[model samples]
Target: MRKHQSAGSAHGLPFSPPRHSQCGCAPARTERCGGLRRSTEPPPSSRARSLRRPQTVDAPSAPGGGRTGGRLKAVAVALAVLASVLAGPVEGADWQAAVKLNAGFTTMSGITHRGTLGTGERIGIDIDGEIERHRTEDVTAGVGASLGRRFGPWLLEAEYVWRYRTDWDATAPTPTIQAITNVFTNVRTSTLMLNAGRTGPFSARWLWEAGLGAGAVWNRMRSDYIERAVSGVRPERRFKRADTKTSLAWNLFAGISRAVGQRWRLGLRYRYIDLGELRAGPFEARPARLFANQGAHELQLALTLK
Candidate 1:
């Protein structure tokens, strides 16, 4: 009989093969009666191919993540910038409530008499005096106040001003009437207005402001006359007072303000106003309009509270 040989080696050996079989067993242990080598690996099952297939792994959201995360971050930044723009510059300023007081001098136009008075033939009453012909410009005193709200650089205010009485006296001689004649005229004015203004930065510590206003004016007038005969005649005095009249008026003004403290300011202002035609007396059927085409120049010192 031929010598038994193990399948692990090319040459068949009578004793066990020197090398082990590829299936991890010694050739002598695996050899059958015909000296055939038995495989150490088992036969493949149906699921074997599926187990050796490639596997996929998902990556974390980092540098190379999807564009969805990047888009979300960009939208957040845009919303922040939009919120800042809508807030506006005045949002940080503390100028919600404002009040102002002012004291000033007012110079006004004089009055002229344009009518005649007939007096029953003894002595005709006439307007013949310096008081009726000359301009009554005087340095009249005044006081005023304003209350309002400030909106950014703009202001809307309600204002009131009082002007003290201004008077003029004159004496003249009339032909055919032997008497010393004198005339006295006086007037006072007040105003109520709605004003609008704008404020702007000037220098480091100064702010410039300008405004325009329109409203009604009140004018009150009184007139008195005295007649004394040169030849020991009794002196007769006549006086007349008229009811106050309201007329349309308007003004324009400008000023520069300096900050005094954290919540106060002081300013110097110049103003021009047209106090419309004011008419006053008709004493004993002697009708006369005392004032017409009136105007005033005002210089004021103003204090503002914020």
Candidate 2:
């Protein structure tokens, strides 16, 4: 009966906690329970949560952009300079090629060539050849080869040329012998020269050159002499002269070179030849010593490879 009564205490009733607490949850009851137990867990607080710093964002960057920009700038500058340099020469070469051939009169300031008339007569009259008399009026042709290299505005070149001319004439008579005289003169000259000059962006080319050279000029004169024969018969005598001399001479040339197109070059130049003396050649008898100076004019058309 006692055991039944003890079990019946709060047995039929639901589990209960201290009435002073506001929580509906209750501690387990002991026999004749008189105390309450405290909970170890903590309640939720009302304080606000801390915010995380906003993550820093950066713009998308191109890979290798800086280095590529620098390299591209350098390339552009180099190309611009190259283009400026080549532009003028390509255009100038074309025009230079077409009108390369030129013709103009020349005057030689040399002394007269005095040779015995082959009549054994000492003819001392002035034998000066007129400006219209010598090989000054014939054709002037030259084969030119120029090798050049350039650095900045300065340039250098080596050149070689060959020039030739000949003249044949009958000198009209007025004094000693009143007969038509036949004369032939031949001149052959070769030149080697070094040049220094300047060039710019637009095929503006110029050069100054000087040369030391040697050449030979030959003059041949032929005639027949007449003598009064017995009983009004006129006999003829054969008279001839062949004269040649080797002379050391120098020449000066100045010119402007223009580039018209890719393969052509145009140039205009003036030339001067100094033939020291006309009487420098061999004469059968003691010859007269006379000095002479010769002048020339030249033009050129050149082809370029670049």
Candidate 3:
């Protein structure tokens, strides 16, 4: 009978008991010398042992994860801010106020009537009269101011304009009377209007605006004239206005505005004024009448408060 025993290795693999040295086998390795090994096989090299060992690899960190997420959050916030600004004022926002001062040229046209002696009573003239269409134009200038409130794309305003030395000339026709007449006038007007408009960014530092409106025009006029008769024995007449007259008119206008500061702007405007017909005299106890139609162009400087 032979004796038998069992053995185990740290790697948990089982093997035969080492043969006794008398059986021509190498001695079993001891734990103090780094544990047992199979005598029939060479020990593994360090590189091969490391390869056989199970390995755990750490996953790579995300690429710029925190920094990229931070940048995206910042961009989202900036876009939200910009959208609010372009959407206009919020509900219940306070009203805004503005004042404008303007100066520019004006032109006037239309008809005038003067009677030949004793040709009156028709068309309500008490003396001989002639009607002529005046196509003449003049270089006249004015000052204006306005106060207004804006409502989204609409604006409501009140304005006053003062016009100086608006004048024109015409030649009277035959049968009634033939003559050349010169006229001089002055006008002032107050108006109320509602306008529709839009505002947009023009550049990094400026904004642009455009608008249109219709309103009433009130006119104050003065006249001076020299009339000379043609092909008739009637003597020439020279007159300086001894009185001023008033008329109600209407107008249409368009304009553009540019922002120059936080509360200042510059603007250019064009207007078509219809003063209809205005009458201004009974000189020397004799009946006379002047008819006029007028228009203007303007540039302005404005200040605003919100």
lDDT for every model? 0.60, 0.40, 0.51
Q: Mind giving the per-residue lDDT tens digits that candidate 3 earns over 1-306? A: 232344555457675565766644534343333564334334567535644677899964333546645644553464444345434565643344566665555655565553422254343332234444455555655555665555555554545555555555544333344444444445554444334455555565455566655444445555565567555567777776644433334455666666666756666555555543444554453445565556556565565554
Top-scoring candidate (TM-score): 1
Give the Å error, residue 237, model 1. Answer: 2.3
Tens digits of per-residue lDDT, candidate 2, 1-306, equal 011223334678643444325544433333332465443323333111112245779964334546645644554464455346434464223111122243323344433444333333434563332222433344556565655545555544445565554332223221243333333344444444444455444434533333332222222222222222233443332233444433333445555556557555555565554432232222233232222444555555555443
RMSD to the true structure for each prediction, in A, is 42.4, 44.3, 39.2
Two-way TM-score contest, 2 vs 3, winner: 3
TM-score, predicted candidate 1 vs. hidden true structure: 0.58
Best-to-worst TM-score order:
1, 3, 2
The TM-score that candidate 2 achieves is: 0.41
**lDDT by residue for model 1 (110-197), tens:** 5544433222233456433323344545556777887665678886666778887766454554433555555566768888776778
Give candidate 2 misplaced runs (Cα > 4 Å). 1-104, 114-136, 168-180, 201-254, 258-291
How many steric clashes does model 1 contain? 0
- CA displacement after TM-score superposition, residue 98 of candidate 3 (Å): 3.9
Q: Which stretches of candidate 3 lie over 4 Å from their true place?
A: 1-94, 114-133, 170-196, 203-205, 225-237, 240-248
Point to the candidate with the largest lDDT: 1
